[model samples]
Target: MTGDTQSWRRAAPASPVTLDDVARRAGVSLATASRALGEHPHVAAATRARVREAAEALDYVASPEAARLAGGPTGRVAVLVPHPSRWFFGELIEGLEAALRAADLDLVLFRVGGPEERAAFFDRLPARRKVDAVVVLAVAVDDAEHARLASLGVDVVVAGGRVAPYPSVGIDDHGAGRQAMDHLLHLGHRRIGLIAVDDDARASAWRTALADAGIEPEDELATTVAWGGEGGAEGMARLLGLRTPPTAVFAHDDETALGAIRTLRRAGLRVPEDLSVIGVDDHPLAALTDLTTVAQPVREQGRRAGELVAAALRGDLQEPLAEVLPTRLVLRGTTSPPGAPR
Candidate 1:
């Protein structure tokens, strides 16, 4: 029986119903039916209804090209990332691609990392004729850019930050900062150092969270460094040289935290003993390093952003679309009560 089933499964199925058949059934031109299927705004409501009914009866599914011919979507989404090579952006792109693939759509990646690239890309509106939606990663842009993005007539989904009038998906950086501060406060750390990166918003959030916790972070203790381990090491080295060096450090991301740990180890200091460390993102390396940190759903954020794009395309987004995921502190070997025995 299994062998017979296998042979049957190998047989080809019938060809899909085409737009011509739908048009014929609806008593309209192929172009009209295509326009109706695309849901072109110019198509009259009555004609669109008739054509859609015909398509349903015929089970007609329009191909990507057919849909575009009718002024519909191109079945492609453009993902804009600040730094494609960075670990965080890489993880996000992976999740976005996975979700897009599941929906039978295509992904087009655009790296607009620096100011020049970003300005050039936006000015050209390269996605205008290329994609149906745009997913912008963690990058700051002014109101004009956001408005220009919307004017391109493509659905925009902002991931990792909020741009009004467009759906956004990300964890609250300020809230996550508060959680990190809360964890460290309970651990009895007074002077905390921050190994921050290029994200000014997140840096400000961390500072605000600290202040709200009644812990005024010292200006000299917080240093803006490069992204990743190298930058983290440099920031830690500077922090360690301070007259009143911090007993604990909170890095912006896990890579930064790992780098800080490397610096401390080389300086003959022990983690959670001489100086505890905590970071955000719970990066892949965080577990290996046993780093105590706040973990947000990076991949999930991307997936949800993709889902939002799909929803907007289907006209399923009747309300303002926004998804703020939660983050939690993952306690590990890197953090402990200050002055506690190792």
Candidate 2:
């Protein structure tokens, strides 16, 4: 009985071992094999030879999919952006396209704006085994979104939000927070207020305390708003109604900042005199309002993300890390030393 059992185990099935199977046999990784055979000039030649031998003995053929990307074939990279016309997403896509073109990779742009389109995207993906990888730019996705992407069994990198188990690229939103707050502190603003984005109040609080900057917002100092200009105006209106209003304000983004300006001016408050204001995102509209901001290098961050993703695609990148970029404080006419609230 023992002899038969051992013999049967030894005489395994004739089906070809996959890349996963070969990695296990070689005491390396699927990534290692791809690095050994592909364009990873950094891998040791001896290591490459070992992988090749194990691959040969197992009669393992490279996945047609891997060859298209990891190898020398013309491959496609799918880039998913939530919306197309938004400035941040548009700049990110431009950077992604620049990188892909440099590598002669095909770029498939998809705008998964709503429920129906997202469903169609995922449904069409299973058959797109030939596609190399995916890039999610600035789209805060839920678990269901991630699960669908994982089901496709392809390399993935997310930009702008922290999607776990996948490498991500973003500015220290918290640092951008600190920078924004620092500007206010330098302007002698103690009675400051905030127009927050969405319902993520913790993010708002954390950003204030980040990098050891800004006033800890009192209950009367900070207010939550929606994601756009209306939210900004509404939050500012609430701040103005308080017994002691803020001398200055910071909004979540440029759009919100503009709304804050509208509210302040309509209330007979003077900019930089009665109520100084600022925001994040150096969006084009921000300039038209002459708003101060923590200017993020949107396109540069996108380019860096592209480079990081490319390194992952080549199998030469092993260390898992969060890449953080820098942001700057851009001063305009809107911000000044805090004065008496009007």
Candidate 3:
């Protein structure tokens, strides 16, 4: 209270205002003050307003580290990939990493390839508070899995395929399939077989296209197999053994198409000469092997999904984004008019 003592106290620099000071001023717990400042949705509007006013009065600037410890963004994203070794997933990861790195976020990968792995991942993710967001890469999440993801209380994004109730970026599978099926239909082929990895939108496109073209879709002409060259080979063999074999075949992807071509070679039937073939996803080997396919912007899908995650984190995204990039048919030596002379 003395004049000299007051003068010395005024001369000393003021202590930086802490979150505790704001909490005391707002008559709330320290955790509540932190949640309000962190923009956690569970805080009441009135409590958040009171905390903001207290922070402003005290000139409290939240440290990034403090905010992170108080349940804010961890600056990391978890990417769930079904097949990490595949080229498609590799391209998606490359694009996603670039975009996330630009946004100053780290990418963590989790492989959920099979039923047991997926179940374990879903079960374990909610128990940990490691990532601020999750990106699912070409994996179909079931209802139970979706519920588990929701329990994480973080943004969820889908890339390379569509998943309902979440932001997503990918090409239209049915549209891409239509492009492939229509190409073969245009090339003077009436009996076109489908070699499918799954009975998804692409398989539906094949059936619809054939029906629209006034050709009955035969069950024997359409075969389901695993994903990859070996599966394609098996499906093609089944088609070839049919009483009335198709003049052209549409494989699920370029790799599968290549496998189908290999089967034809083994059977002494030349590609596009004895039977035409087409596929989706213009994988790098597709061009090298001269396989015709529907080219999708696979990497772009990943990049866009990363951008979506960034926007959602910044609270800039107004709504859940469902972006569908375009796909185009790429012609190559594998496809031609049915039975055209070699």
lDDT by candidate, in order shown: 0.80, 0.74, 0.87
Q: Flag regions of model 1 displaced more than 4 Å.
A: 1-70, 126-128, 198-201
Steric clash pairs (candidate 3): none
- Tens-digit lDDT string for candidate 3 (1-342): 599999998899788888779878987655456667888654567778888999999888898644753596578899999999999999999999999999889999999998888887899988786887899998888898988886675778999988997889999999999999999999989999999999999999999999999999998899999999999999999999998999999999998988999999999998898999999999999999999999998889889999887766654443566899999999999889987998
Output the TM-score of candidate 1. 0.78
lDDT of 2 by residue, 1-342 (tens): 999999999997877567777666766545556656675553556666777888888888888765543454336778888788877888888877787777666778888888888878877886655566788887777788777776555567777656676778877776786677778877777777878885453246434563355345486677888777888999999999999998888788888888988988898889988888889989998888788998888887677667766665555455556777778889998988876443
The deviation in Å at residue 195 for candidate 2 is: 0.9
* Candidate 1: residue 339 Cα off by (Å): 1.7
Candidate 2: regions farther than 4 A off: 1-18, 21-74, 199-202, 205-216, 340-342
RMSD of 2: 4.4
Query: How far is 86's C-alpha from truth in model 3 (Å)?
Result: 0.9
CA lDDT, candidate 2, residue 11: 96
Q: Rank the candidates by TM-score, best first.
A: 3, 2, 1
Tens digits of per-residue lDDT for model 1 on 1-342?
998999888885777888778877876555456656877553567777888999999877778767555576567888888888887888888888888888777998888988888887788774445676788898777887876674455567888777776678988887887788778877888788888886565677667767877887689988999888999999999999999999888888899888989999999998888999999998888898799989999988888888876665554453556789999989999988888786
The clash numbers for all candidates, in the given order, read: 0, 0, 0
